[model samples]
Target: MNKTINQKAWFFVVPVFVLVAFNAVIPLMTVVNYSFQETFGNNVFMWEGTRWFKQILQSERFHAALGRQFLFTGIILVIQIPLGIAIALSMPKEGPWVSVCLVLMSMPLLIPWNVVGAMWNIFALPEIGFLGHTLNGLGFDYNFTQQIGDAWFTTILMDVWHWTSLVVLLSYAGLMSIQPAYYQAAEIDGASRWSVFRYIELPKMKKVLTIAILLRFMDSFMIYTEPFVLTGGGPGNATAFLSIDLVKMALGQFDLGPAAAMSLIYFFIVLLVCWVFYNLMMKNEEQS
Candidate 1:
């Protein structure tokens, strides 16, 4: 006899569906509506088709912002992934210190993003800031506010400080999930640390690492508040990522149509990249 499925669970899911519709779907639909329409003022809208999309796509400013966004994400991924793995590996597997280490690692992640930016901004100022004063005292011109290179450096450093902990935590969790049998076998085979990690730990951690990478990629790509607080897209648009540009267009310039179009494009690019990453990761897992 076939077992009957419980239909009562459907009621529980309805609330979640409604919540998602209100939070994500509704906002997305609004953006989509704005993207394809033009408004002069006072809630008046006229169908503009794909005019805004084409304009945003063709604009050199959008292109530059997109390039910078990609570059920033790439740099963070490169720095954080390896650094996190190394830190996780070095931590104690079983000890009183494990709790201490974990808490320390989590401290940065607990701070508000805007606060992190503001703190870093103050900490890196050329005159009164500790970092800036020390660097300048050492005869180096370290002014993030006025210098493009210094601004990029400070932003990257701040992100690494704030987010690398997340990678470390994920990597540690992945490491913790490994069965003792695997280590036993590796030890019995006289396997080196590199060999053990390469053959065992790394493969096991792939799933979590994929998650870590995706989270970091999305966060870094969509980053706004911190960079906005710190740089204000200053030194002449040097640090202005897509999100900042979109905000500037929508609010600063009051160009809602183009901004909405750009936001939709931005949303899709993130979605597409994430889809590709998930596919590639799953494919690798299947092959392995």
Candidate 2:
């Protein structure tokens, strides 16, 4: 006799669905509505299908922001993934120190994004701040507020400090899940450290690393708050990623139509790129 599944479980899910609809679906519909129309004061709206989309697609500012966004994501992935993996590899698989190491690695991830930015902003000041004063004393003119390069460096460093812990934690989790039997087998085969990592550890860690990379990419690409707080999208828009640019368009310029259109397009671009990365990762997993 087959057991009947509970139909009442749908009732349990309904509240979550309604919440999602209220929070996500409603705002999304509002954006779509704004995207296809032009508006003036007094609630006047004119139908302008795809006009905003086309305008945004052709805008140099949007393209520049997109390019910068990609570059930031790329740089972060390059640094964080390798560094996290190295750290994970070095971390004790099991010992009294394991908890200590894990907690230390995770400490940075606990800070709120805006507060991290504020902390860094103060820390990196070129005069009164310790970092800035030390750099200045060392004969380095470090002024993030004025120099575009300095601003970019500060933003990148802040992001790395804030988010690298995520990669490390994920990588560590993956490392922990790996069975001791594999290491034992590798030892029986007299495998070197490189060989063990290459043939066993790396393959085992692939799934988690993919997750880490994807998460880092998406977070870095969509990053707004920390950089905005630190640089305010200055020194002259040098650190203006796509999210910052979109905010400027939507709120600063009050161009709701184009902002909405750009938001949809940006959403899709993120989705598409993430899909490609996911597929590539799966293919690698299959191959290994």
Candidate 3:
């Protein structure tokens, strides 16, 4: 006799599919529509084929913005991942102080993005801000508003302080998930701390590190609010990344066509990078 399989589980997933279609698929389709068309108010739209895409691809502005976006993301990943892992390793694995350390590590992440920017803006003032005053006292001519280098330093440092905790949290979770038997085996073999970390801990933590890197990459690439609030993409457009440039084109100058095309390209680059990361991570896991 043949057995019948239950097919009623479809009901459970249908709502999610419908919701995603409404929220993501429809909006993406609308963007694709605008990306290929030209508009000049009064709901007027003309078919422009790939004109906008061609324009964005040829524009030096987009090239510069793309370069800045990738640079920001690269810097963030380089700094945050190792730093977070080190911090997480230093924290007490199990003790009364663990909670306190975790809470302190998390405090910066709780602050709102715009507020973080505003706080940094005030705190970096040459005369009034404590940080600026302290840096100046230490013989560094740090002034985020007036100097391009200072602006870059403040932005990178602010991002580090704000988001590094996320990496720490993820690393800590991964570290905690390792079974005690692994440690026991390492100890039995008289493994040094470095040997244990290299052979046992690093492998276990790879999955989490992959996730942390991807999150940091995407967030840094798409960052707008804090940098915008802090710099206004000023200091001579030094902090103007792709998102900022897209906003300026779409809303500031009302060049919807180029903006829409650029946005689509921007979205695809992110998706492609994320896909590559996922594949590489899985391949590494398989090899290990």
Candidate 4:
């Protein structure tokens, strides 16, 4: 005889569905509406079809911002992933220091995003900030406020400092979950440090590393507040990524139509990249 399913379980899911609709679906629908129409105060709208999308896709400003956004994401991924893994590898496996190291690793991740930005802003001021003053005193011309290279370097350094902890924590967790038998077997085989890491730890950490990379990629791509606070997208728009440019268009200049279109495009690009990353990483897991 077939067992009957409990219909009551469906009732429990209603709240989550309602919450998601209220938070995500409704706002997305509003954006979709604005993307195809133009408004001039008083809720009045005129159908503009795909004019805004066409314009945003054709604009050099959008292209430049997109390039900068991609570059930032690429740079962060290159730095954070390997550094995080190396740090995780170096941490004590069993000791009081484990707790202390974990706590220290977690501190950066706990800070608020806006506060992190503000802290970096003050910390990087050329004359008064500790980092800026030290660099300048060392005979290096380090002025993030006025130089494009300095702005990029400071921004990347701030991001790596804040987010690398997340990767380390995740990697450490992945490392801890491996069975001792794996290491015992590797030892019996006389595997070197690099060999054990290559054959055992790396494979085991694949899923967590995939997750870390995706998280870093998405966060880096969508980053705005920190860079905005630190640089104000200045030094002649050197650091104005897609999100900053979108805000500038939508609110700064009140060009809502193009902004909405660009946002949708930006959303799709992120979704596509994340999908590809997840699939490729998962495929490697299957092959291994």
Q: Model 3, range 1-288, lDDT digits (tens) per residue?
A: 997888998899999999999999998998899999888978899999999999999988899999988888898889999999999888889989989989999999899999999998888888889899999989998888889889888999889989999999999998999999999999999999999889988899999999899889989999999999888887888888889989999999988878889999999999999999999889878876
Q: For candidate 4, lDDT tens digit of each residue in 8-79?
A: 999999999999999999989989999999987688999999999999999999999999999999999999
Candidates ranked by TM-score: 4, 2, 1, 3
Q: Rank the candidates by lDDT, best first.
A: 1, 4, 3, 2
lDDT of model 2, residue 240: 92
lDDT string, candidate 1, 1-288, tens digits:
999999998999999999999999999999999999998779999999999999999999999999999999999999999999999999999989999999999999999999999999999999999988899999999999999999999999999999999999999999999999999999999999999999999999998999999999999999999999999987799999999999999999988899999999999999999899999789878976
Worst 10 residues of 1 by lDDT: 279-288
The segments of candidate 1 whose C-alpha lies over 4 angstroms from its true place after superposition are: 1-9, 284-288
- Check candidate 4 and list the clashing pairs: none
Candidate 2 residue pairs in backbone clash: none
Residue 236 displacement in candidate 1 (angstroms): 1.3
TM-score of 1: 0.93
Point out where model 3 deviates above 4 Å. Answer: 1-18, 284-288
lDDT of 3 at 37: 89
TM-score of each: 0.93, 0.94, 0.90, 0.95
Number of clashes in every candidate structure?
A: 0, 0, 0, 0
- Candidate 1: residue 31 Cα off by (Å): 1.3
lDDT of residue 85 for candidate 1: 99
